[model samples]
Target: MAAPNDVQISIPKNDIEEQGFKDFDYSQRAQWLRAAVLGANDGLVTIASLMIGIGAVNEDARAMVLTGFAGLVAGACSMAIGEFVSVYSQLEIEVAQMKREKRVGERGEKEEEREKEQLPNPMQAAMASALAFSLGAMVPLLAAAFIVDHKVRLGVVVGAVSLALVVFGWVGAVLGGTHVVRSCARVLVGGWMAMAITFGLTKLIGSSGMQL
Candidate 1:
């Protein structure tokens, strides 16, 4: 017979894994996490869409590659700058809060050092975002690099982008402790939507006899 005061508890496998990874404190990485995952995803989607959009009107592989390369460079720079500014602002706010709390005086050097160690790093965030953007942007570029055929090139680019989207979404979901299927589906669908809209719009405009 079971004791009346006893209660049963169940811990899921995923929960156990998550708990194991909790040693480092996920909240501390929020700033850099956005820099890496979101930046990479943005780069992948933006450059792929640009290439697809350009490919719609012009079948030339050179044009698509050039546009993608340009977008990747510009996007990477923009992402780095934006991430740096955002993280720097966050760091400033947190530091200000610490000062307001007089944590420095009360906690002494060790505590102050610990607080500093926990602070978000702007340079690190900026670099992570830039590198991540470049990595994501390269997927479509590489896929279309060697293929000269117009239709085939476009198809390959789309396929590569789709795969990259799913991968990025899955990685992000895992890191953020979210539902893998939902995240993958969400990003995959969004990427498809963006590319489809861009391609359709560009094709429609090209068909209208507009000199683009």
Candidate 2:
């Protein structure tokens, strides 16, 4: 039954397993990365635009820094609470789904545990979101905190916010397996528009007969 020209190809089990692991679903990590990216970008953009708006009307470094600080605290807390509630709701729904599917029987114990491992952790997500927001909001606050000259402080905040925006974009892109250049450009342009609009509108209002 043997032929000299016959050949058999065999693949090792180990190699098959390694390939399986390598081809894992990337969407699994998308949930966590989405929260982090959203929190960071929101914190940076909100505080930067707010500070720029104030700077457009007033030259006091103290007021701008204080406002930024207050915003950072409030933002971090809001992000944490929001993420916690959202993820907890998701977790509850998934748990209810497993129960409704009758996946909690004795024979299903192992499978149930495995499925639970994939569920989102509300506390972990909340902490990560809050920390990311605080870290992002700190960029502009630190940039404008020490500088006394209003114009220079404004310039530095803009520069620092720009740099941080690029960094956040790149980091988010890398984590999410996306195009870095496009992400960075989009983030930077959006940030610029927000700052420009806030500064322009606030300036117009201040320059007009609007007292305050």
- Show pairs that collide, candidate 1: none
lDDT for each candidate structure: 0.89, 0.90
lDDT of 2 by residue, 62-145 (tens): 889988999999999999999999999999998887776675464467656756677898998999899889998999999999
The residue ranges of model 2 lying beyond 4 angstroms of the native Cα positions read 1-22, 103-117
Highest lDDT, which number? 2
Q: How accurate is candidate 1 locally (lDDT)?
A: 0.89
Evaluate candidate 1 by giving its C-alpha RMSD to the native, one decimal.
Answer: 4.4
